[model samples]
Target: MQQQAPKAYIIVSNDKNEIQKTSAYTAKTLSSIIKTCLGPRAMQKMVLTKINSIEMSNDGNSILREMDVNHPSARCLIELSRTQDEECGDGTTSVLIFASELLNQIVPHLKTLHPIKVCNILRKAKDICINHLNTIAMEAAESDLINIVTSSVATKLCCVLKLPIPELALRSVQLIKSSIDGRIDVKNDIKIEKILGNFDECEIIEGIILEKEIIHSQMRRSIENPKILILDMPLEYRKGESVTNMEFSNKNDFTRALEIEEEQIHKMCGYIVDTGADIVITEKGISDLALSILYEKQITAIRRIKKSDSNRISKATGATVLNRLEDASPKHLGEAGMFEYVKIGKEYFCKLSKCKNPKAISVILRGPTRDVLTEIERNFMDAVKVARNVLLNPKLVPGGGASEMSMALKLNNSNDKEEKIIFRECGVALKVIPSILSTNSGNGICLDVINELEKKQNKDGPYFGINGITGEISDMKNIVLEPLVVKTQCIKSGFEAVMQILRVDGIIESKSK
Candidate 1:
């Protein structure tokens, strides 16, 4: 019999030797990478790319996505931050810090405690933390919510993408606060566009604008009280899927075939003109022949808009997208108050206005460079997302680590003997966030600040926390605020990810034959 070869594997099976070798190392590794991006004073990292370009970002996901991480356990923590960003849009780094600290506490206890027991204890502690968080949450004032958005934007852009953006975020939240169905749906209702100009020139348009230009220069540039038509099918003759070859015996047959195609195009144009539509926006191309007729009839025709733009046009103008030319009936036609074309520099924008109670709106952003514009767009997205979440939850939490300190104080003082260690550990774990905030802010005596803040939370109230700037504890509720959903989601997502990493003992890799 041939001797069996040894199977290569890593053992982390809740045992001391493996726990330190595998799980603890992963928690420490991931936390070290993302902890620098936690608070307002967190330092920005300059990521050197493969192409030798340098990019700077303080966003947790943006920084994590650029990292060179290979450990499986470390990757699970990355997923935790990603989920937090998707669900809460902010506080991603806080989630990672909380999870890492929780894992750090559980390592020594793994000798006597079963992984399942720890998980159960964490679940209970999470509920306790969440309850305390809700208790401290306050009704959001409109100004407070605006501050939340602005603060989040400032963190992402270092106060460079400020000014009208914060104000724009405020107005946008109000406009998209309540959907027709009375639910939070700002992501769908908002549209963004980038054009060439100064950032100061950017403004919100109450209606949709197509990037497409007029196909015929002879067509009228402005039409008032315009009837808008949205078309999905081509405004020209298209051959069917099956291939067919026609043999023309003489020149007349070929000429007649050409006539037939032109006649079809003309018929399509005539149908559009008969409908009294001032503008025809199509998802497919419009033949030159059709354009000629439409131009002669003084109708504005824009060809080949994206499907997403087409849908918005329908919502704004109430136009039904037709599958066939025959569907262009009065009942199918949509109306808008005004339709016109505007030229900015060399670009043409199809601007629509006076759509009664238009639901979709676009905020055009401009910058001097492509990179500047790209960063501006991302910053705006983060701001808008926070605002939308506030509308949905309608609860505000004190920022500057106030909520964490308060929750930590609450969970540590719990009297449950059975899970006392777990609860206290979770409470202690919460302190790492504020500590990291102080350290990242360049405070060498950061631990002293955390102790002072925790003491203040106990004496003064849950609202007092250290200001990252001055290292002095203050009323965070009055000075700093954040959406309540971000804090709750960080806890909910962080605990689940920590459990998943802890439960893993051995990493088995198989080799293919």
Candidate 2:
């Protein structure tokens, strides 16, 4: 018989004998990168991009997304990181680190057992983990909505603070929520209007709002009794009446047609006057006759609005024009009279309000510098997103280190009849539970402590070893666990992600070979 090509066993295989032996290596490397950033003591990573320069953050998702990865196995871990980012926005590092440890712990057993058998065990264990998580989750007490908001804000404090323990994070959360009497979404709907001179004079409003800037660069510093004109129609000349073939060469006929065009412009100006418009915003350039009429009325005019500068106005003030004004009255303009001009760079502000929606909310965050402000804004927005989800769902479980411990404990005690055989064959897999807890604690001494616990419980029921050492699941009924809520959401998010990943099995092969 011809000698067979050297055979090798690997966990994941692709054609051409390209074995995937790096999952273990990739998981270890990824875990080490994120382990240091665990808990409140975490520090930020300053990432430099090609054009944007740098971003400073300790956030796992930000770090993972910013980092360039080439290894296929590492990319899989990155996908898990993305899943965590999308679900909770925070705890991405925690999720990835936990997953890494879970995969690492299972590697040693792969030597004596088939990869498929390992996978089956893991599948059973994951199901038990989820079921136990559900039980522990039900045991968790309902969290106060206020506490949930406060806790979310607290987690973001490290990223938000400039001098470490900056007080504004708490105060901002309180201020944002104060208007709605603790209702999170209602508080978010409240907008900060503007700072009247200093921070003390800051005002908040509640309604649709916009921050408009001046239209013309040369407009006066301020116009007294400014006429406000709003129009929806174009200012170009209407189609001239079709000229007859004989009239094409006749200069006299051309002159008569020009006069008719001027008359149409005059008619448009008459309509503006009829509507009592003081300032005109038009879709097209004003005809000379219309311009003259506007000057006579002392009505300021801005042209080519949708094209000329609508984007800047929209971004600055967040106001959107719904319709063109036909006949506008002073009172109908509401606060439109309060237009004020302020200059920044080459831009001038002419704040206008149609009195349609009056409320404007501004979130003024105080930090050391502009970069800090940007980072704080990102953190605040992420927190706000998570807070909104909590408000909608209101159910939470332990997350981070706490979640890992809870799940391990639950799995040790989980008494599902169908899994008893696999549980026995696995030979006290629960013995590994304490090790999982120790890995997350980031303390070698804690690992020693867990090892001691495991030694004492080896004689107990097959799955009782981890339970004995890690201690029984206490009644979490009275205590409010903020991370738990985030954790539960994250697990559900992870399950959804895994299901999606499982839907596509095996990578597509290139036909070029």
> Worst ten-residue run, lDDT, model 2?
461-470
Q: How well does each candidate superpose onto the true structure, as a TM-score?
A: 0.91, 0.61
CA RMSD per model (angstroms):
3.5, 9.2
- The C-alpha local distance difference test score for the whole of candidate 1 amounts to 0.78
Error of 2 at 351 (Å): 4.6
Clash number for each model: 1, 15
Q: Candidate 2, TM-score vs. the true structure?
A: 0.61
lDDT, model 1, position 139: 92
Best by lDDT: 1
Top candidate (TM-score):
1
Q: List, residue by residue over 196-279, the lDDT tens digit for candidate 1.
A: 787678787767876767889889888888888899989888776898899999979999999999988888887888888888
TM-score, cand. 1:
0.91
Instruction: Please give, for residues 215-319, the per-residue lDDT of candidate 2 as tens digits.
Output: 444444444434454445656576537863434577688788778888777767776676554556555566666666667765666666643233323222333
Q: What local lDDT score does residue 308 receive in model 1, on the 0 to 100 scale?
A: 81
Each prediction's Cα lDDT score? Answer: 0.78, 0.48
